[model samples]
Target: MIESPDGERTEHCGFIQKRGTNNIAELTAAIESLRRIPEGAEVILCSDSQYTLKGLGEWLPGWIRKGWKTASGSPVLNQEHWKLLHQEYLTRKVRLEWVRGHNGHPENETADQLANRGLTLG
Candidate 1:
């Protein structure tokens, strides 16, 4: 879900047919949100996944520098998605905000609900 600058909310939840992890879904959400907005638009991208947050804010640069390897020299998981998300993120002015999931954050709660609804889509 994305809340526009004018308080308009847009939902972009859907189920994936293939097996995937929660991190994949989270990354997809962030990636799709950035894809929807125009390049260079200022965006306040909120999420409840710390993996998504830290991976984007902290780990991404080092991972890229190390050819997508982690600190311990293991290959980074979800390389393709990270690459796409990183590319999308770089093309925009995005400020990532991490909201605690299931902590009474209305937007996060709504996203969770939407995600649950998406399960039926499969």
Candidate 2:
């Protein structure tokens, strides 16, 4: 995430996560981005995954109460990360923004790099 001056009291925060087919990894990155910010600060979350954006914001709570199962009774993938991210969201202040991927945004580029770095290390 990159924080730049946005007038006096607010800062412009930019976040990027690597492209992933797995919804969980991308959502995890989004949660991580939120966690990196200070509490009560306004944040702008930029992500390429609509699933991650909508799932966390819209689908999560129901999934949690449903024992991490999909509406059709299939076990949800990446339940642990989902739960962790849910907890993280409860503790931080943020806003979500969707950005087109691979458009050469700097923070997006950096986050892609960081995500790849984690992949390589594992």
Candidate 3:
């Protein structure tokens, strides 16, 4: 889902692959949002998934250092999506914000519903 400064909101839903995870969905959302938002502008990405936020913020440097491997010597799950999200992060001025889900936040609730709707589309 993307929201404009003028209070316009848009939601997009589709499968990233035959198989997907929540992290992939979150990363895809960030990447797609970056594509939608104008360049050189400040953006805040609100997400309920700590996996996505930590993967981009606290874990990226180490992942790059380890050649995309986790601390346990395992390859990072959703490495491709992480790389894409990282690239967008480099190209855009984005701040990842962790929001509590189902906490009465209007946009968050709407996004959750849209995500559920996407699942039913299949």
Candidate 4:
């Protein structure tokens, strides 16, 4: 879910792939949100998954430095998505925030609802 500074809120969702993990879903959400937000805008991209936030905040740089490989020389799990997200991430001023999931965060609840809706969509 993307919320505007004027209190406007929007939900984004879709079938990412045949199968995916929560981390992938989080990355997808961040990617989609970053794409939708205008360039040079202030962004607070929040997620419940540490894997996604950590990848963006910490692991992404190392992965890039290591040529998209992990510290152990294995390929990063979601390189394609990470690449896109990283591209968008660099174009804006974004504050990555980690929110506790299912703890009554309105945006998180909306995101959950949107995700559930995706399960029923074509």
| Tens-digit lDDT string for candidate 2 (27-74) | 767666667677767766677788877777788878888989988989
Question: What's model 3's lDDT at 57?
Answer: 79
lDDT tens digits by residue: candidate 3, 24-105: 7778877887877777778888888898888877999999999999999999988888888888788777788899999998
- State every prediction's TM-score relative to the real structure: 0.96, 0.69, 0.89, 0.93
Best by TM-score: 1
How close to the true structure is residue 112 of candidate 4, measured as C-alpha lDDT? Answer: 90
What C-alpha lDDT does candidate 2 achieve relative to the native structure? 0.68
lDDT tens readout by residue for model 4, 20-58:
877788788888889999999999988888988898899
RMSD of each: 0.8, 5.5, 1.6, 1.2
Instruction: Tell me which residue pairs clash in candidate 1.
Output: none
Error of 3 at 120 (Å): 2.6
Which pairs of residues collide in candidate 3? Answer: none
Candidate 3 local Cα displacement, residue 6, angstroms: 3.1
Ranking of all candidate structures by their TM-score, best first: 1, 4, 3, 2
Summing lDDT over every window of 10 consecutive residues in candidate 1, give the lowest-scoring window: 9-18
Where model 2 places Cα greater than 4 Å from the true spot, the runs are 4-24, 120-122
lDDT scores of the candidates, listed in order: 0.90, 0.68, 0.82, 0.88
lDDT of 1 by residue, 1-122 (tens): 88788898888788877898999998888888899999999988888999998999999999999999999999999999999999999999988888989999999999999989988899
